[model samples]
Target: MKITGDQQLIKKMNKTIVLDTIRQRQPLSRADISAAIGLNKATVSSLVSELIDSHLVTEMGPGESSGGRKPTLLHFNRSAGYAVGIDIRVNDLLAVLVDLEGHVLQEKTVPLADFTPEHVLEQIRKTIRQFSKKLPESPYGIVGIGIGVPGLVDDKSRVVSAPNLDWNQVDLYESLASEFGPNLHIDNEANAGAIGEKLYGAGREAQNLIYLSIGIGIGSGIIVGGELYRGTSNFSGEVGHMTVAENGPLCRCGNRGCWETLASEKALLDRAAKLWSDSHLDLEEIIQLARGGEPRAVQLLDEIGARLGVGLANLVNILNPELIVIGNRLSLAGDLLQDAMLRTIENRSLSYHRKKSGVAFANLGIRSTALGAASMPITMFLSEPDPALAQEGSPSAGL
Candidate 1:
């Protein structure tokens, strides 16, 4: 149980769950909501009434009757309040604004010449300020801001260890909260990618799913039974550090022979630099070259994909999730890489969980983690208890 210093926070949280559920899955009846959220009938009724009163949810026509009178369908007012997601990458920043139903309303990108936490924060703040100006009129204001970072995140929104950004123990939560005034949330990029995919990507239909973000560094975001599964200390998806090549290349995290050294985006780039270092090319360029019958680039990507599949094979054997989603820069490489990874994984997996699941590309592509950042603020923007839970903010509410 969590003892909060505030009581109003508890009430708002209760209604927030109902509102979020309606927004995520529309046209749900109160009965369906209660069943979906495991809340009792009376609580659902009160929360639904509160949402309708707030103009966040509205009752539609009747739904099919389940013995009793037909229940009224409920839906979120998509125009209620907006959420912004930000993706902080090594080369650029992707910012997207989504409405209540997780629809993208606006998107923008900014270039980054270098990777510095302080500089990125300024750029992020400016981008957020500019993006907020474009939102349509709303009553509740922008609910929150979610940030997808390329490093480890504590529950308090601090960047514990982002090897790519070289940020260690930086309190980004305080920095953003100080400027934005409490509407900031942060998570490892992989976790954000996982949530974006879970809520709106290929894994949306699966309860147990793994989202592998194979970018400059390899990381994973896990979802078990329809919610993010953060392990002790909230850094569950740091699988990139998992050892693959015991004596392989040294990693920025001071580890040797890590899976990241084999399968990370930088790993591919490191191999590519030997082939072409005259110009700084984006990930798309490599994919384009590999696509345009460039055998060397194609071969390089295939090998990288094979190694990534090898790394994931271990995870699949252990997690046995229903779906495996691949995201980030290399995902844009398409089937050329996917085929190699698939072949390798099928060969390595012990046949039982082999065909039990399928690999698919992220619908949101590289922007997924950033779009997930848009979802992050949902927690921060929402200060109240979730209506679906028996107790507000209890671990089970989203654990």
Candidate 2:
């Protein structure tokens, strides 16, 4: 029978649904998929056949049947494609090569001595090439690349401002697209972290969660209803700039008493510097000191934790998220910060609002942004009806 345009679209969507079902509940038979998604046996078999032909699904040996003949089980082909995720951190870049399932195949950390966009771009290119060299055999080699930038990324994937990187109005998409092709994504690092946590880390079960990236400066990724809440200008979640203190310390953004100025990793370091004018201590050293039961270090971390709780309390009252995940550098001191942070939140936040909220540290450690960034491209690549579109370098697709 000749298929109409709408019929073809429907078929493509069904095929996608079939692939997703297999990915989510693998090692299931066609009858199982049909029953799970309410599709007919014939339609499910047809879509699964197309997926198998496309190298996205593989058939395994028959599974035990209730009384009749055994059924052939299907599995999603995770090794069919690969993606690259990069996190452009303040001091370095964290890059990872991941399979379709978001498992890291290779990981690298490149230090950044120069913050210039040109230099950073070169390092990114070099890192991708290194990853490509070590790539495993796959049908779709390097399906796409996703980058998480430490700045305000506009809807068009332009870096509007990143104070830590000294970047403003940088068009990373344009620069990288030529060599990398069309399947690319650039977003704020915190947004990427939120996605990472939601998909594979602490926020996996929470439909509404906030991922706070507390580092040199505070930033956040707010997930509302299981999706990142990008504001009207795609510049939401700049929680660091929120005014918490009327007469607080000066912030790099030219504001007084912004939340980051009082509660971020920099804030902790600034206070530590003042206490130990004779010695220089990084975050790791300070955390070690606190762990060793040092009075001053413990007190300092407690103070930072309380300050962090102030902002978190505000977030809790406003967003009422199911979970709040603290990530990035400050999260390394989660143990040291938990007591004071929770105490302050208990004291300050609305009792009703804080009751259902649970706070936790990042489960993926520092790789949240990198893995999340990588997942973006993988998602886009998989949503396409034709896998050849990725191979042929077609325009961007979405999940």
Which candidate number maximizes TM-score?
A: 2
**Model 2 alpha-carbon drift over 4 Å, by segment:** 1-3, 394-399
Write candidate 2's Cα lDDT for 1-399 as tens digits.
456888988988998899999999999999999999999999898888888888999998899897899999999999998899999999999999999999999999999999999999999999988888787987778899999998999999999999999999999999988788888999999999999999989998999999999889999999999899999999999999999999999999998999999999999999999999999999999999989999999999999999999999999999999999999988899999999999999999999999999999999989999999999988988998889866676321221
Global fold similarity of model 1 (TM-score): 0.84
TM-score of each: 0.84, 0.97
Per-candidate alpha-carbon RMSD to the true structure: 5.6, 2.5
Report how far off residue 319 is in candidate 2 (Å): 0.7
Encode model 1's per-residue lDDT on 1-399: one tens digit a residue: 255545566557667777778877888898888998888989889878876876677788999987999889997777766777888887798988888667888888999987777888899888777767776886554676788888889988889887677779988777776556555678888899999998888987899999989888888999999999999999898888999888999988788999989888899888888788786666678888988989988898899989988987988888888998989987888687888898899899878876677778899998789778787665454434432231223211211
- Please give the lDDT score for candidate 2: 0.92
lDDT agreement with native, every candidate: 0.80, 0.92
